[model samples]
Target: MAPKITVIGTGYLGATHAAAMAELGFEVLGLDVVPEKIEMLAAGRVPMYEPGLEELLARHVAGLPGSTGRLRFTMDFAEVAEFGDVHFVCVNTPQKHNEYACDMSYVDAAFDSLAPLLTRPALVVGKSTVPVGSADRLARRLAELAPAGGDVELAWNPEFLREGFAVQDTLHPDRIVVGVREAGGSAEKLLREVYATPVAEGSPLVVTDFPTAELVKTAANSFLATKISFINAMAEVCEAAGGDVVKLAEAIGHDERIGAKFLRAGIGFGGGCLPKDIRAFMARAGELGADQALTFLREVDSINMRRRGHMVELAREAVGGSFLGKRVAVLGATFKPDSDDVRDSPALNVAGQVHLQGGQVTVYDPKGMDNARQVFPTLAYAASAAAAVAGADVVLHLTEWREFRELDPAELAGTVSVPLILDGRNALDAERWRAAGWTYRAMGRPRA
Candidate 1:
């Protein structure tokens, strides 16, 4: 029989992790403090928009594969401690209020609640991205709290799944990194068992000490954020040099060393992960008294943020400065395409900025309008891009949704008050849009 696994905190990470574990043929129990979340998950409903997650949940939650004992959801920590052989702490560590430091309260609460219930020997794995010392602290806490005392082993296993590709990333991860104490245990073997399918499919597994594992996640996010800011910073230089940033990026991408994955020169990155992770990483570095080592991230963050201000400036320039009464249409709201999560979304931030500057901003997103409204309630939301662009002075293509890309420029030109467009994602076809009698503008491109 497979080991019984319990996944705590059923947000995006926990939800996908729990589902993937069940699909891996484990008797999985998912626990959350929120009763509504557990109730919803138990009934085969996902609270957010992630592709393929809902279908996977529905399939497993209906009946546990040939038997009725498949995936289970509960709010009780005691029940989880009794059932699970390996418990995964998958809680979120979001940024604190008005600071770059991560709020570790949720992670602490998970350990506080579940540690006392461990009556016997069990493995506790942390999948959340945390500071370097978190795993060491939790290991000591588990030793003191669990009835099994020193028998409870702790491991750090950080997740690298992006929001849009959470399910796929979890089921078929790029690599697995596990950090354990010097005493050592069967964590690697158990994790190997848990991820047999992916391992067989050619995913590498890395094992190391606690700090290295913790550093890997923050380092990865920081690199990604740096890549994005690097391109956006080039976009600024391109604007001054009257050169094309897209062509520059394409040229640099041919080097193989500077691969063109996150070279998108747009309004910059903002989601639940990149922005917060980089900030938290910087904060952690400061706390560790090695602030000089990570000081460059400050510029990376500033460059990314400056792109938003650049978009607003472009918008102002398009409408002859000072948007006192201009009608502006924003094409998308979510940070990126394919996901409806709007935490620190750049598109919505631009919309709000434009609205605050007296521009009548009408925003439209295929899926992010509801979430965007929840965050920016004062901004005008339209049912469709056509509705948003109706009688608009300028159109801002902020988020690169496929629906927005597929939109006919000629059709939009006919409806809008003006045919001027600012492509924030650099996704629009220049020749096609220009041929349609619309003035097309994009970031990192020579002005036409």
Candidate 2:
């Protein structure tokens, strides 16, 4: 028989994992400490803005009309312990308040709460982005706490879900990596069974030790951050040399060695993962006495953050070198498109800095207004892009949403007090804006 699954921590990762598990034909029970989140998921609703998550829940959540009834939710550790044969701990490992290390308090609390209740043989899988040695330490902790002792095993199966494509990514992962106590152990066998559907569908499964699995997520994030910062550094060079970065990126991308993915340099990378993950990676490396090996990550962090200030300065320049008495319009607030997560969003950061410097800023996002407003309550928020740009001294395109790209610049030409625009993402069409009777400027591009 297939193992029944319980997903702990019903945040973005936990909720999506539970839903995807149910969709794969398993009986899934999702647990969260927060009663409200449990209640929301039990009612087939998601607390956060993830595309297709609510619909996935509606289809599988028990008691919903026309649902498969394979999924459920609870806040009780006792119920979770008795119900699941395989438990997935999907808690968050956020960066520490004042330090660069990851805060594992939530993950620890979840394990401590659930471990004692595992009186039967079961496998506990960790899916959090944690420090490399975390799984080895946690494996011992689980054995020490569980009454079943050796019967309860541990595996590190870190999550790699992109914000916008989480559902699809979970349902059909490109690769399924599992870190077990030993190769061909019961934990690995159980995980292989759980993922048999995807593996059969061609998702390669890489079985490894605990530390390798734990390092995969942070390592992947650090590499991506480096890529984004590398291109942004080239953008800085392009600006100084009067070279067109867009054309340069296009030319270099043809080599297939560079492969033009993160090459569209703009405001650099931001979000929950990239910024803090690299910092935490560096901190963890330092603790392992390998700080010198990862010193370049500090420069990567510096370059990414510098892009935000550069955009702010460009906006100030567009407004005659002073933000005071200037009405700045900001488009998009989330870190990237398709999700309403505003954690450390470069767009909101730029907007907040301008607002603090005496600029009257109005912001608009297609799906991120509520979350963005919560993060930047003092900044004015508009109902639509047109409303945000109306009566503005200079318009700033910060986040590159499809709605922003599809915006008719000609229609917006008559709204602003001054027809000057700055493309922080370098995603907008320069010719379209310039032909629409507006002076357009973007980083690393010549102002023809």
- In order, the Cα lDDT scores of the candidates are 0.90, 0.93
TM-score for each model: 0.98, 0.99
Instruction: Report the lDDT tens digits of candidate 2 across residue range 110-220.
Output: 999999999999999999899889999999999999999999999999888999999999989988999998899899999999999999999999998989998888899
**Each candidate's root-mean-square deviation in Å?**
1.5, 0.8
Q: Write the per-residue lDDT of candidate 1 for residues 269-310, one digit (tens) a residue.
A: 999988989899999899999999999999999998989988
Q: Could you tell me which 10 consecutive residues in candidate 2 have the lowest summed lDDT? A: 253-262
